[model samples]
Target: MSRATVLACLVSSSVLALTVAAASPAQAAGVDYVALGDSYSSGVGAPGQSGLCLRSNYSYAAQWATRNSPATFQFLACSGAETDDVLDSQVPAMKSGADLVSITIGGNDAGFAPTVLTCLTSSDATCTAKVNEGKAYVANTLPGKLNATYTAIRNKAPGAKVVVLSYPNIFDTSAALCEMSMTKRKAINSGAQTLDDMIKARATAFGFTFADVRGNFTGHGVCAARPYLNGLTIIPPQNSYHPNANGYTLGYLPALTSAVS
Candidate 1:
C-alpha cells in the first residue's frame, strides 16, 4: 500500500477506537432490560405520559433504565392491565435471556381498584362487604393468577434477574380515610397486605426478587402528612391512588436498586 493509504487506515482505526472508548461500561456488557406490568409500572402519575398507554419517562422502569443505561430497554407495561394482560401481551415484547426485568401487578387481578371504588362510592355496610370480598379474592384467586404470570415471565426471560414489586396500602390502617370509613379502610389495607404476601411468595417460587414498598409508603400513605400517592383525584379520576413522582423516583427506585444489586 502507498504511504497515503497507510495514513488513512491509521486515522480510521483511531476514530473507531475513540468511539468504542466513549461507550459506557454497561454498554460493553450488553444488557437487555424489559419492564413489564400494570399502571404502577407504566407511571400514570409520574408525568410525561406517552400515547394512550400512559407510559412516563419518570417511571420506575424508565428511571432504572436511565440509571443503569442498558444496551436496550423495552417498556411494555400498560395502565389498567391485569395479570392476564401481562401474560398475553407484555411478555410478547421481551427477548429471550433478558438481563434485568421489573414488574408490578396483581392489584387489578384481585379486584383492588374496583374494591377501592366500592369503598369510595358505597354505604358503610356495603363497603365492608366489598372489602371482605376483595380479601377473599386475594386469598383464594390472586395467587394462582400471579403464579401463571411469573412463570410466563421466567419462560420468556430465562436468564433475567426479575424483580417483582408489591403494591403499597393506599390508606393508613389507623385513620379514617378521605372517602371511606375507618372500618372499611382497615379492611382494604389488610387486603393489600394479603395481596403483597401472595406476590412475594410467587416471586420467591420463581427465584425472582420481591421489592415491597409497604414500609416506604407507611408514614406517607394516602392520609399521611405528605402523601406520595394521589388521594381521590376527582378531575382525572383514573389517576386516583397511583403514586406521584416521588413514589417512583424516591420510593420504588431505591427498592428496585437494592434488589438488582
Candidate 2:
C-alpha cells in the first residue's frame, strides 16, 4: 500500500473510531490468541478439518498455537465469512481479553470467488467485466467494511496485537500455459492486489500490523512449480482458489510468526 492510500484509510478509520465510545485497553495477560475471518483464515483447502466452517488444524492460526502453546486459541474463522458475518457472528464469540488476534478478510466482500469462477467458465469480456466489478468493490466499498470490522475487533480485543494478514495473488501470470487466458489471469491478479491493498490500508489505520504474503507466495501461485493455493476443483468446489495445507504452514505461518515476533 502507498503512503497516500494508507493515509486515506487512517483518516477514515479515525473518523469511525471517533463516533464510538473509546474502549479500554485489554488488561488480561498470558498468551490468549484468537483467529477470525473467512476461508483463508479458516483453512478451507487444507486437510484435517471438518464441519461447515472447515476449521483446520493446519491453519496458520492453529499451527501457531500448536507451536507456541497459547493459553487459549479459538479458531473461529468460517469458510464463506464476509465482514458482516465477522461483526454479527464471529466477534460476539471471541474472548474479550485476547492478547493476540489475526484475521484475513475482505475478499468475500469483493466477490472474488464468484469473479474467478466467471473467468474460468465465461468469455474473456465477461471475465474482464467481473474482475473490474471486484476491483471497484475493493477500491470503493471494501475500506468502509474493513473499517467497521477492524473497529469491532479493536473494541473486542483492545490490547491485542492484531495482525491483519493479506490474501496472495492467486495466479502466476508468468506461467507458460495456464487454464485461464493470460488476460484473465492478469486481471484477476490485479483485482487481488486491489483487495489486499484495501485490507492493508484499513488494518494499518487501526494501528494493526499488515502482513503482506504476496512476496512469500511468489513463484507459488496456482500455476507455479510448487503451488500453495488450490486451483479449480469439481468435487469440492469450495476448495477452489484457497491455499493448500502447505500455504498455511509455509506461506501464511511464517508471515504471521514474523509479524508477531
Candidate 3:
C-alpha cells in the first residue's frame, strides 16, 4: 500500500481499538451502588434523624455496601413508599453506570399500618377477613410494579446486579406485650409470607436476586426470640411497629450481605 494509505489504516485501527476498550464493562475495581425501597430500606424507626434524612447508619443496604468499602454508594430509599412510588419517585433517582442495585418495597402497598389497625380493632373473624383483603392487595398489585421497576433499572444501568429484598414478619401476637390475638398475628404473618413469595417469584423471572428475609426471620419475628420488631407502645421509642437498630444489625444486614456477595 502507499505510505499515506498505510498511515491512515494504522490510525483507524488504533482509534477503533481504543473505542472498543472504552466500551468494555468496567472491572469490579469498585462498584457504584444505588439503593431503592420503602421504610425498611430507608431505616425507619432506627436511631437517626427521620424525614428527608431517612437513611440510618444501621440500614442493611448501607451496612452491606460499607462493609465492602471503596464502593460508590447512593442510597435513595424513602419511608411510606408503595409500588407506584418506586416507579415514580425512586426509579428516577437511580443513575446510569450503577454496578449494583438493591431494593426493598411493597410493604406499604396494602397499607400495612391500616390493615394492622383493623386487625387490632376487630374480633378474630373480622380480623381474618381484613387480613385476606390485605393479602389480595399485595398479590394483585405489587408484582407488576416490581417488574416494571426492575425493568427500568435494567434499562438505565444494564450491567448492574439487582437484588430485591422481602419483608420480614412484623407481628407476634403470642407475646405478652402483643395486644393482638395470636390468630390475628398468624393471619398477618401468613400474608407477609405470601407477599414475600410474590416478590421472590417476580424477581427471579426478571433475573434479579431475591433476598428472603422473611424465611430468615421465622422464629425471630416480632413475637419470637427477643422480638426483632418493636410492638405498639413497646420499650423502644422510635416507632410502634418497626425493626429496631439491633434488628437491622442482626437480621437484615447479614441476609443482604449474603445476597450481594
Candidate of highest lDDT: 2
lDDT of 2: 0.81
Estimate candidate 3's alpha-carbon lDDT, on a 0 to 1 scale.
Answer: 0.70
Task: Give the C-alpha miss distance for residue 68 in model 1, angstroms.
Answer: 1.7
Backbone clashes per model, in order? 0, 0, 0
Over the stretch 1-261, how does candidate 3's per-residue lDDT look in tens digits?
443443332222110011111111233337787888877887865777355636776687766665566358888887667777778877777878798888887777765766666676679898888878977877887777777877887888889889888888877555665567788888888888888888889899989888877655556666665666766533222345667776677767766667765
Cα distance off (Å), candidate 3, residue 43:
0.6
* Winner by TM-score: 2
| Residue 23, candidate 1: alpha-carbon lDDT | 28
Candidate 2 at residue 130, lDDT? Answer: 94
C-alpha lDDT (0 to 100) for residue 1 of candidate 3: 43
| Model 1 regions lying over 4 Å from their true place | 1-29, 173-177
Q: Could you tell me every candidate's TM-score relative to the true structure?
A: 0.86, 0.88, 0.82
- Candidate 2 local lDDT, 115-216, one digit each (tens): 876787789899999999988888888888999999999999898999999999999878898888888988888888888888888888889999999998
What is the C-alpha lDDT profile of model 1 across 104-186, one tens digit per residue? 99888777666766676678788778877877887888888988988898888888889999888888655554555777777
Candidate 2 wrongly placed segments (more than 4 Å): 1-29
